[model samples]
Target: MLKFSILKCLPVLAVCALLAACVGPQKQTAGYDYTAFKSAKPRSILVLPPLNETVDVNATNGMLSQMTMPLAESGYYVLPVAEVAETFRQNGISLPVEMQATSPKKLREIFGADAVLYTKVTQYGSVYRVVDSSTVVTATAKLVSLGTGDVLWQGGASANGKELGNVDFGSGSIIGMMVQAAVKQVAHSLADKSQEVAGLTSQRLLSAGQPNGLLYGPHSPKYGSD
Candidate 1:
C-alpha cells in the first residue's frame, strides 16, 4: 500500500516542477519596441556620446564610437561624426572627452539632426556566490523628435554572462576586468537597441508624415515636422 501511495505522489511533484520551469525568470530580449514613432524612411541622426554613469574613464565615448559604426555601416542616416564635432565647436560646446554628456534632442535642433539617440549605462555588477555567478548591465535609449519636444520611440536592454572566479577567469576576476566585461555586455545590448531605433526612426518619419506611410522615406517633406 505504501509503494502505491509513493507512486501517486511522484506524478504530482513532477507536474509542479514543470510548471515552475515555465514561469522561471525570462531571458533578456535586448530588442526595441517600434510602436511609438511613426514608421518612415531613415533620416539623418546625430550620434551623441553616451553618458557613462559608471566610474570608468573614457568608457562612454568608446562605447558610443563602437555602437555608432555598425549603424552607420547599415546605410542608416548617421550624422557625419566630423560635422557633428564641427557643429559643437561652432556652438562653443567643447567635447568632454574626459567627462562629457551631449544632449541628443538639443543637438538635433542645432545641427539639424532629425532624430537624436541618447544612451547611458545605468547599472553594472559582478558576483560569484554559492548559488550563482553572473555579470549584468542596463542601458536606456530615447529617440526624440527634433521639432517637437515629443519622444518618438524609447527602449532599453540588458545582458549578462556566466561569471568566472578570479582564479578560473581567463583575465582573472579583477574588479577592472569584471567591470570591463559588464560594460562590454551592456554595449552589445545597446547596439541591438540602436538597430531597432534605426528601423523605427525610419518608420516613424513615415508614420507622422505620409499618413499612408512614406515612399521617399526620410526625403519626405513631412519628416521632422509638427
Candidate 2:
C-alpha cells in the first residue's frame, strides 16, 4: 500500500517541479562586447544634448541637466555641458541632431574627449487615465569611442512617477466629473513631474555595476574588476 501511495504522488511531484522550473529566473546575456571598451580605457566622456522625440519641448534640456552627475559618479570626467552647448552654438551647431551629425573625427579634434555619450528622450510626459495620472520618462544612451567611432556601450532606462489619485466624485453628474478631471489634468501639467522621472531614468542608464550595465571606468575603485 505504501509503494502504491508513493507511485500515486509521483505525478503531482513532477508537476510541481515543472511549475517551479517555469517560474525560475531565466539566464541573462551580457548584450555588449567590451573588447574595445577595455582596450581603449577611456577616461573622459562628453555628453551631448539629448534629442527629444516627445511632444514636450522642455524634455531635451530637462533631461540633459540630469546626466552629468551619474557619469561622474561612475568614475569618469564629464565635460561641462553648458560650456559644450556654448561652443556648439558659437560654431553654428544649434540643434542636437546637428551636433550628433558632426563627424566623430572632428569631435575628437575639437573636444579632446575620449568618448561621447549620445542620448535620446523617447517619452516624457504625464499620461492621464480615468482613475489616475502618471508621468513617464524613457531614454536611451550610447557611448561611442571618439577615435574609432565604434559603439562601446549602450543602455536605456525608463521610470514612472507615483500616480496621482483621482478626485472622488461619488454620485456626481457626468459633466461635473469631466470638469474635475480637466482641472486635475491642468494642475498635474503645472507640476512638471516628468522632470523627476527623467532624473531617475538618467541615473539608471549611466550608473555602473548593474546587471547588463556599464563597466566601471578607470577612475573607479572597481575599475578593472568589472
Q: Model 2: clashing residue pairs?
A: none
Off by over 4 Å in 2: 1-31, 163-184
What is the clash count of model 2? 0
Q: Which ten residues in a row have the lowest lDDT in candidate 1?
A: 206-215
Q: Model 1, stretches more than 4 Å misplaced?
A: 1-36, 39-42, 73-75, 95-106, 124-137, 160-226
Best by lDDT: 2
Best by TM-score: 2
Provide the lDDT at 196 for model 2: 77
RMSD of 1: 13.6
Q: How good is model 1 by TM-score?
A: 0.47
lDDT of 2 at 110: 89
TM-score of 2: 0.78
